[model samples]
Target: MSDPHIISAAVQEQRAAIVSQRDFENLYKQYAPFLLRVCQALCHDENLAADMMQEVFCSIWDRRTTISVKGSWENYLYRCAKYQYYNHQRSLSRFRTVQDSVFAASDESDDSTQEHIEYRELTHNVNQLVEQLPDQCRKVYQMSRGEGLNTAEISKELSLSEKTVKNHLTKALGFLRRNIEALFAFIFLIS
Candidate 1:
């Protein structure tokens, strides 16, 4: 691999100009492998590392208009990759927490075996309902209820207004409540 500083300098010089697709491709060719290695080290999965790299590049492209290269583009790219990696880990952690809570709640019931099965089913149904939500609403709900983040935190993290975050949460809860009611009615009818 050539010196990263050389590539970084080239990118920095062109940072103020409009990034053409050719420039973006050149940047990707130079940085993707390095960023992939960073992601793979954090995730320990090749496919996930590649996905993360793609996401990072996509993010860069999306925010290209306002992007400012301060010190080193290499460092900035690594920071973006690291942030994405931690975000993925946080999502996984939240999922595991949900599973653990479901088991714990079920275990406390008198009919543990039956309760466990019911709890699993309820969790599955809730997950499906969440997946059906619009992208922003689903993300807000996950960051709030799933990761236990406050509305202000979610707003900052997602670059949304606090009111927007509240609206998404409200929308998600309303959708979930309606679906859950229907699901319960169907279950009762079947049982």
Candidate 2:
């Protein structure tokens, strides 16, 4: 004879395996915000983060019938968010490489050469200005802009409050802005 407990366990397993629309809604409600925060922390752009988070949830819904969760949903969703953010970044890098090649091939005239030289000079000047910033300010600026880290990550990594990180970044940018204005004016007069 069939064991009653075994049959009941099998029934519960079958029910738990299929996520209903209501179950999906509940998961979205509970984790969407958290997922969005994860995306933002990775990329620091609100709209892009939102889009990536939405894509993760949409993909989940599309594959809901075949998906099996063996662990906690939070970890699963967090991995999904990270995967989406990295995927988007990879795509952007590829697109930029292609775009740069196209632009490079299309512009080879004297004006293009002059523009390239100007761009190089401007970049060099910016680097010099960045290097001139105070030590902590430079580190904060580089982490926030060069490494694309958000203020919170910079705060944690540097063991400073978020407000202090912001202050450093602000001072660094302000100093750069003031100096770059002078550089631009000098360039404008020359051009």
Candidate 3:
């Protein structure tokens, strides 16, 4: 069996090295997969879980100078991941609440009737512009804006590279901006 003193010395050396980028990279390489699994189990969405895992690592790296892991590093990392997941959930909940309130207020406003009509017209025109986009660009723009999918998710669903998806979205936006300058200018004046 290995000597307990030797094992203790190795752990002490590792703990002392945690402030260095190389040590942090080693820690990330060793623990990122396990942390991602934990995040996936908690968040229940692959994209959100990946984001949470990244956030956990970012927090760890930011706090490296002051972090004090008393016991198992695995436990400490898991706790950080859990906290990040909870924070993400809370932020999403708050955003939804604010969105709901805004919609509710808008619905209750009779003065907004004309504004709503104008908004719908603008939306129809925008849809027409989107439909006029090249086939691949139209598909990417629709999936991103109408379906609310992120670039990575859109890339996976459509079997395209993420960079390609981004390029398509950029092209679509540029097309819209050029075609809808008048409508956007009106919007800019109002809001």
Each model's TM-score, in the order given? 0.50, 0.49, 0.54
Candidate 1: which pairs clash?
Answer: none
Residue-level lDDT of model 1, residues 2-79, one tens digit each, is: 999999878777675436788787888899889989999988998678667877887788776777777766898899
Can you write out model 2's per-residue Cα lDDT over 1-191, one digit (the tens) per residue?
99999987776565454368998888888888899899899999986776677678778888878876645778888899889878777756655665575467557554777667767987998999999999999999999999999999999999999978966875676567557666655644553
Worst 10 residues of 2 by lDDT: 182-191
What's the lDDT for residue 13 in model 2? 68
- lDDT of each candidate versus the true structure: 0.80, 0.78, 0.78
Question: Top TM-score: which candidate number?
Answer: 3
Which clashing pairs does model 2 show?
none
lDDT of 3 by residue, 1-191 (tens): 99999998887666753688988888888998999899899888876676667667767788888776766878887898889878667755655665575467568886677767867997899988888999999999999999999999999999999978976876677567556765554544554
Backbone steric clashes in candidate 3, count: 0
TM-score, predicted candidate 3 vs. hidden true structure: 0.54
Instruction: After superposing candidate 2 on the true structure, give the runs of residues whose Cα lies further than 4 Å from its correct spot.
Output: 1-18, 109-191
